[model samples]
Target: MLNRVLAVALAAGLVAGLAIAVLQHFTTTPLILAGEAFEKPAGHASLDPAAGLRFSGATIILAHSHGEGAHDEAGWSPTDGLERTAFTSLATVVTAIGFALILMAGLVLSGDPIDGRRALAWAAAAFIATGLAPALGLAPELPGSAAAPLLARQIWWMGTAVATAAALWLLIRTPGLWAKAAGLLLLLAPHVIGAPRPEVYASGAPAELAGAFAATSLVVNAALWASVAVAVGFFWQRFKPHAS
Candidate 1:
């Protein structure tokens, strides 16, 4: 039983980790797109009939907006090429594997054996503490978009919590084909709900700038949940089949 549990945990962890990494890599936009507008310039032009005079002037302005709101998104750049993408993916994979190993060690020491009920409880706690709370803006703002809409942030967080809970529940309760399908659906739920769109610039922005800030949030959130999942799985494994 222990062996079976461990095998399943490892396999699930790997898939979760890989998904997180790939999502992060693809979603990460160039640093330029992550910035906020520092200023907004304005000008006015008028013509006078009496003197037949025309006047036009522009003034410099500044703002606190940062990240996704900074400049026309056209300024942002994508990763140099496929090679850089591969490197990022590899980095995420390594981090995921390391996290899994650590979780396995912790589970072995928790004095309880892994089981469905325990896994569900742990996952639930994690979802509430880490996922739900952050969705409510209890968590710090992400680096790229300091000015991201509060409502949008809340939506993202709520979606994330639901997805995580569903995935964990399915994995712990029913480890079968249908359960796997449900888990995958949970994983992809956020994409369907979509993220906040960047405010359009009158001047136009770069093409690669599409969904830059949203992508960053997705990556960061995924990493956080992936870490929690591995940790919960490890600890659950340790406490399962505890000797009374």
Candidate 2:
């Protein structure tokens, strides 16, 4: 049974991760390349290394208002060539598979017979636990973006992920109002403590590009998580014991 569960999860992850990588090539990767262009001009490489940039509402509005250009993603560059695409695909697959296994374990702990439907729910929870929640404090950074102290960000990021995961597990699996309330508190605790922020914010990338990247990255992650969950769920259900 354990082997079967793992097999199903691995299959699901393989497919979803490939899909995400393809989507990212067209979506986030272009933005990433464009952001890199600004790196040299901004004197960012030699400047502050500990000031991570984040997307503000303004940058997204700017990106939407403009159309394609050099900074806005014009003709494809050699940077977005086959090699990069292949590497990205490989990395994404590994990441997705890891998450799928985590989700499977969570389902087991839920005391529910793993099924497609529950797998989907667990995926959603996992996303919240690992991605979106933690991102509340640390929006994805583009290359050359300033970052907070490495140690600080790492601590907060890990703590938030763990707290969020625990909260979700309690909320979903534990019975009773008190249990649910506890979950809600855990969910809020990390945020209350706040994510570590850079002493200052700076970026080589234009705000418009940075904003677009952050927004797109979040969207990409959302798709990746959902696809992995559904795929994992489907395969898990297919492998489960039939009604007898």
Candidate 3:
């Protein structure tokens, strides 16, 4: 039983980590790269062309022309190199493991029949608290340097919500290969769609950073859904009565 629980926890954690890494790689990394690329050319023109070459090695360069100024009031900054990427990835994995263990323990304790609607309601509340709440404050504040195209960001968020909801609904309500496939698709959708791209760059910054925010939200929601699944599975197992 302990082995099984450990296996489930590890699997859930791995999946969650992979999903986050892929999303970040496709979404946030590109924005950072774009910011870097833009900074090179913009800085070159604003400063000595030769001096701009010196800035190439710098992972993040903050340049503000007389009028360009800083991005929105938000103090968000672009992620640097592999250090930030690795840190983010590690954080995702750790969070996933913690969530899986907690949910598994909760489900084992509850020992009640799975209630799809109740599960969904709980999932939705978790989604709002974990996914949307931080976004409300963090989204707008993301440094303008990482700003992505508005339409693309909107599509990413809408798709993420729909995919995540569908994945969770199916995973808990149905038990079949189809549900698994749906969940996989939900996990891969952001990468398939190609995360939002930068629309414009000024002073080495994108106009908006919503794509990164949306991607982060998606990752959080994915972990929540995974927790729901582990919880539901544990509940069903614990509550099943043995033959007399």
Candidate 4:
């Protein structure tokens, strides 16, 4: 079981991570670079510049896995695009591994045989739950943007992700009116409750750029999750025969 998990995770993570890293280089990373210009007073690069899916928060979570010192928001940053890009790639792979584990674990718990079609469905649901659900409440933020307390926002995002996933499971796996209604409520609950709100609406970056950042985060996440699902799904089946 352990070997199977590791195999699927590494495969999925590398494929998904590399893909998203490329996507962000062109899509979200530029926005972050632009936003950083407004963050520092010197108008030079900020210390510990931001990275992949910078708006979505995944990059930070994953980068820590590579090494505790990989990213230090407090430290001074050098103007090294190559280093930043390399780190971003590492972050993406690490993040993908974590998410792939979750995906594969869900399948194991469900006792379902893996296949491309089912994997696609799983990936879509995962994307909806983890990516879209939280995003609905908390769109990605740029530097210098007004926002809620970090802990509060994290709590809300987590709750939304869990609720959305539960709702999806209920709707897809269970039948009957009660199950359906419950699923619907779970789906709507978080949005109705709403995400953590900013205390004051403000940002150093232009409103347009901020909007672009948020939209790009959502789009990139959707694609990343979908691709991850497919890759993991393919490898899971391929690796299954050897797990025994």
Task: Give the TM-scores of the predictions, in the order they appear.
Answer: 0.35, 0.79, 0.42, 0.81
Off by over 4 Å in 1: 1-13, 25-79, 115-117, 130-244
Q: Please write out the lDDT profile of model 2 over residues 1-244, one tens digit for every residue.
A: 7898789878988999999988988999888777765453233233233543323312221221233465455344333478668887899999989878887887786687676677777777877877899888898988767888899999998999899988887897789999899999999999999987766677767788888888899888878888888888788767777779
- State the lDDT of candidate 4 residue by residue for 55-141, as single tens digits: 233333222123366456345443347987898888888988888888788877898877767767888899899888788788889
What overall lDDT goes with each candidate model? 0.50, 0.77, 0.55, 0.78
Estimate, for each residue in 1-244, the C-alpha lDDT of model 1 and write its tens digit: 5664455456555665677766665555343323322112222223243533233433222232224543454354334458556776666656555544444443455554544444445544454534443443333332333244778866777767667666765766667999988877876676566655546422122223434444456446556445546555554556457677
lDDT by residue (1-244, candidate 3, tens digit) is 5665666666666666667666767765566555444454433434344544244454334442222333443254334567667877887777766666655554445563444444445545446434663344235323334457667677676766566556665666568998888877765565566556555545434445445545655664655565555554554455455779
Ten contiguous residues minimizing lDDT sum, candidate 2: 57-66
Clashing pairs in 3: 145-205, 145-206, 147-208, 147-209, 148-208
Name the better of 1 and 2 by TM-score.
Answer: 2
RMSD (Cα, Å) for all candidates, in order, is 13.0, 8.8, 11.6, 8.1
TM-score, candidate 3, is: 0.42
Ranking by TM-score: 4, 2, 3, 1
| lDDT against true structure, model 4 | 0.78
* Error at 53, model 1, angstroms: 32
